[model samples]
Target chain A: MEDRFEVSILLDFYGTLLTDKQIDIMNMYFNEDLSLGEIAEINETSRQAIHDSIKRCYKQLKNHEDKLKLKEKYLNKKTEKENLMKELSKVESIDNDLLEYIDKKLELIINI
Target chain B: MEDRFEVSILLDFYGTLLTDKQIDIMNMYFNEDLSLGEIAEINETSRQAIHDSIKRCYKQLKNHEDKLKLKEKYLNKKTEKENLMKELSKVESIDNDLLEYIDKKLELIINI
Candidate 1:
């Protein structure tokens, strides 16, 4: 099975669009790593109800991702940042201040 | 007036999402730097019609950009790339091969 970690990543991109209750449940399930029963206990709902809500919310996040692809572009930029950083680390003679400047700029590119 | 060049930049980021006809007219107006009458002559439509269409399509492009901010992010990354390139150019001690690789990878980050 795929890792639940992806849900949290998707949440980072799209969590604001989701309802407050949905975001709460998702945080508990994905961020807190709580099972449905644990979430249900805190929310005063049945485990089955929490399960259904989580399923629906996951679908919503996936739909948003499929349409906008913000996460995909972010991952691509991040990979580029990593590759450039590796190259920067290998060069022995570059100045410390220059290295720091390049590093910060590279991160700024990926920060979007 | 704001630069018409911006529409072309926005088109580069969000053009495919626009309809074929809208994109065609946008290209004629922004890319070709054509006036409304010039666009209408080629499309066999009135200048007013072409004007309205351009207005609508510009609005559509703005809407997509508003929701996604892909253009904003793209510009940010591009600026970051530019700054890094400038810094690289000033550093005379860096090896040519390493410099080229860094430039290419920095471009890759903004490619998205």
Candidate 2:
């Protein structure tokens, strides 16, 4: 379960850097939860080739994250923004429209 | 002037990945406005070496930015946050405390 979530986050961060074939295999295995043989059948490749491509894709994603740490920075910013939103909500006499506007800004930060 | 600002932005984005000597040369050349000969004298290297290192550093920074684009993404988010802040301030009956809190959150996003 933890590994699944990690792959999802990795895909979010570095998926664009991967080759199209790698992405297709990853989407099949992780997103679709297909077996290695299933992906091989879909792509008309050997199961070993499908497995190897997925492994290579994972390593590339990890390497990119290791070099950049963009995902770590993004997660930190997201946590900080959420905490700020909580504090802003607690401020006395804050208006609903103002709160909504602030919420929108925070959503932008987290989504980025 | 435009080139100076570009270097500053580039430095901000990829300064971490540069070698210590490269960073020193960049700081002296761009931030301190030191000439190549002056930087060479300070670093005890040839003026040509200083020039070469600065050029290499700039290329490395540009390549990093091309691959990741974190700086570009940051600037876009900052612009969006500023616009949201402007809209937030225009909302009716927003208290000073709420406005200040929202401003703080926006600052956090921009600074990130």
**DockQ of each model against the real complex?**
0.44, 0.42
Off by over 4 Å in 1: A1-4, A11-68, A94-104, B34-46, B86-92, B95-97
Lowest-sum lDDT 10-residue window in model 2 chain A: A90-99
Worst 10-residue lDDT window, candidate 1 chain B: B1-10
In terms of lDDT, the poorest run of 10 residues in model 2 chain B is: B88-97
Model 2: residue A33 alpha-carbon error in angstroms: 2.9
Q: Report the C-alpha lDDT of model 1 over B1-112, residue by residue, as the tens digit.
A: 2258889788887786777889899998888888889999999989999988988888887877776677787887788778778778778888788788888877766776
Q: Candidate 2: misplaced stretches above 4 Å? A: A40-52, B42-44
What is the clash count for each candidate, in the order shown?
A: 0, 0
What TM-score does chain A reach in every model?
A: 0.83, 0.87
DockQ of 2: 0.42
lDDT of every model, 2 decimals = 0.81, 0.79
